[model samples]
Target: MEGKNIIYLNDIDGKTRAFTIKVKVVRLWKRSNPKKAGETWAIDMVLMDEKGTKMQATVWSNDFKKHEKILQQNECYTVFKPRFDKNNQKFKHFDTKYVLTFNLETTIRKCNNFIGPTHGFEFSTFKSIKNGGVSSEFRTDFIGYVEEWFAREDTTTRYGKQSYKMDLILRDLEGIALKLTLWEEYCDQMQEYISKNKEEEHIVLIVQFGSVHDYKGTINVANAYYITKLFINERNEEIVNFKRSYIGKASVTTSTHRSIGQSGVTSNEDEFLHNTTFSTIRQIREIAQVMHVIVVGTVMAVDKDSEWYYLGCESCNCKASPSLQFPEDDNGSDDVDPKEVLVCTNKKCKRDVVPAVHMYKVSIQVEDCTGIVNLTLFDRDTVKLWGLSAKQLVDKYLQVSDDEKTIPAEFNAFINKKYAFKIHVKKYNVDNKVDGFSINKLVDDPAIIAKLEKKFDVVPFEEFDSMILPTTVSSSQSDAGVKDSKSYAVDDSTPLPKNYESRKSPCDLKRTLEDSNDLDNSYSVSSTKSRKIETKEDIKAQMKDKLLIPKLEK
Candidate 1:
């Protein structure tokens, strides 16, 4: 083989072995290290021979521009007089013990007769990655469909370098969802693909040389190194078969699964309904995000203190607050009507106040034997439950006497009534609880309620005690050294002791403390009159007696 001008990747050694071999550029990327001095960029590439042997190769910054355009991916090329270096195992992404480096004398020419393998990807399944035991130094290839993607965010790393990151939820053939992160150039590439192919559904993502990481208990895959490459919806036999077998036939149309009750009042209520698993209020609160669950509870009370309706702009349908402008001669009187004179806060809606529409924003507190939670019903769900629009409710309230400006009796019908709520739990954030609940479907059918009641009766509370219950920490046993101990009752209806203080949600307490701190930082004038300032000359004379004079050195 050596006499025929052919050398395999396994034959390469750190010695100055001169050879000409045909190989294909499998992957290539630029590596930038901020900690390095000038010219800190290098072009890295993975080359595979015709025999399926792979090795790492690099073009240093000085020679990168001259050879970068010549090294086309998947194209066969014959390299002459290439230098061999002992592979750095710590940064190696291939299986070879030696790596190739191009120098000033190294020459490369296109090999028309020989075509080598474009890539040597060893694909791994998400199940195997989740089971662990994979070496951190090893890089794996993965392929899946994009289940969902989040907007890209600019972030600053601890090294004081700026980069962009985007999160993607990838679903495998087995319907298991795994989170994949794209950083820097990869993020920009994916974002561009998404924007250009907005109408192209069923995009298959192929990630080569991605690192498997275990964050907390969830396993995910991310770009391993700078040379990690991404392919989207490429025309290949493996990807084509994957889509056909796992994602169904290409002729079949995929259904768009939108969230329930999001399509306004015209959407079919039954279309979004699901026969979800029954859970208690406590269980629902503790469940993970995006889970569909059914909770049966009685409306304990109506929080009328919160606004039942908000003024929204007609064009954008965004909530609008009243403008601060008022009549000069009004004398800050209460007779001024806000709805008649207010302006929409949305900058897009430059129209008058008459175009503002009324939207419902109702808050109801519901409770079961286990626990309690506040459910926020939006416009569509609010009208479905109350059988009246916010404008109609406002009209009815205005018909009553001026002294009775309270919530109408029609809204109070939900109090003390039992109903099963189908909800898709939003992700919980420690700083905000209001965004954690989204009511999907409201079920009032007696037969469905009866079936759920029978199902709950068969299951014992002890079964879910370990799974859904929130762990409690006693004050005496807490590691924070908190001495004031308090206990929470499972049954929310039970009255608390006189000394027991009610607990507020973390979000509410955080906001309250922040507001108090802002108030404390403001300067307050004690008197209505302003004090006169002393001139610089007056201050100098006043400090003359206190001023110290240094003696002259002899």
Candidate 2:
């Protein structure tokens, strides 16, 4: 391995281009284009030099086929005349400032006598990860052993599509535990391994290039889309040494139970939920990221004037909207129901037309000592609250009355009721200045409510009358780094904003329903430029129809 002609990864600079270098393909993955179906975006990889320095590199979709068969993970090759580009992506796997790109003239040849470490990993400590000392912008590697694992779950993603996920409690050698989530194929791999090794203890897991997330002030790791590599109980040198040194020692114990969502809550998640104090409605509004918090509030009133349910796609549960293209009755059949043939608002849905299912979207005004805010209950939470699915309620009300707006008498169960609501506040709500929060989990059990009330020093329900909604949000709230507030309303007869077509999250549907009329609120979207800003008086004037959630100082 000799020569002054060979370039190393660290030798690249701003002016470097079309250079020859010898590096090992430590990792390789095919990047998919989310916008285009079945289309690859690029061929991405991590390349390590002879000195153990690594750099990010890619082959564009146009040139991917040229080197698809030649490039292999853990194989060293001499890459010739590859162009250099700045590594400025939002999520990066390495610390290199520049990434190599294969161009028309780029060539490669296998290096037979390559000498260097086959793998390069710089793992962060569990303490540093929990303390927020590591940079979350770049992906990092971490290794731990599975102390406890949850059963695989089939859950809906943010877009309302069904997906598989698995949760595990991983403990490092230092006795610190961390939560890890595996999505889709990763779950299948883990399940396969578990099925083969029934009695095996101390399952080691190494998450390579995993994404770090801070949820509710606790750090967790999840496998990234395609570039993440998962090594489960592999007989690598580090894993062998880790198991040999700590196999027979005393291990930490954790008791897990199935939570409301049929998912097991890890020890850390349980601590954050039960041990932490409740968050007031005022504090919930100040949150600018995705978080879960418990809030105790009395349901002042329900908006029975609006329709309480929307039709969702049967395939994915996304809100369905009327499409210009109706079902074709080739045989002149009478079986096609116009209500059933609707377009799924979720872009991920593959079908052009899908049958619809009734999903609840009940908005209620909730009041606590802090302030009054609107909370919308989706299908699952509403079903738990009323003990009836949206379809069953709709059928019951249709039998007794002809008016669709008249809610079932059973809906009165929510009025004047005090309950602990686990609200999931998303950044979409904060960014769009939407006041209505979505309830993911609702606890009405008297025992749990009483415990929470005693823990938070609760004020009696009679005293909530003194806590009135604020008429105007303080201008200082904007100066405190919160984004500028804007109000948007959609006119169903008009076309929606172009970007709105891609907005498929549950929060987006809730925001639209809050701003628009009941008849066509399911998939409505309005542009900021077309809507006029409402003043304080205008906001206060609409309080009778839409109760304004005030952003007040804590």
Candidate 1 structure quality by residue, lDDT tens digits, 95-162: 56778888787878765444444456667887777787555576788888776788889999779988
Counting clashing residue pairs in each candidate, in order, gives 0, 0
Question: Could you give candidate 2's per-residue lDDT for residues 1-554 as a string of tens digits?
Answer: 22235788899998775667888887898888989989989888988898989888888888866887898776778887888878887767778888888866888776644567645667888888888988777788898877777898999998999999999888887888899999999888887788765424346788888889888898898988777888776544455445544443442211222232222332323433564446766566556777768887767677655578998865466888986533323233445545333678999986555556688888777766444666777765565445466777788888889998887888877777877777767767667656666776565555555555444432322222232323344565423321222221222234334453354321123323333332221112221222123343443343334433433354
List runs of model 1 lying over 4 Å from the truth: 1-3, 14-16, 33-40, 62-69, 158-160, 249-253, 256-554
Question: What's the true lDDT of residue 328 in model 1?
Answer: 21
Q: What's the lDDT for residue 227 in model 1? A: 68
**Candidate 1 residue pairs in backbone clash:** none
Q: Model 1 misses residue 152 by how many Å?
A: 1.9
TM-score (C-alpha) between model 2 and the true structure: 0.45
lDDT of 2: 0.65
lDDT of each: 0.59, 0.65
The alpha-carbon lDDT assigned to residue 106 of candidate 1 equals: 81
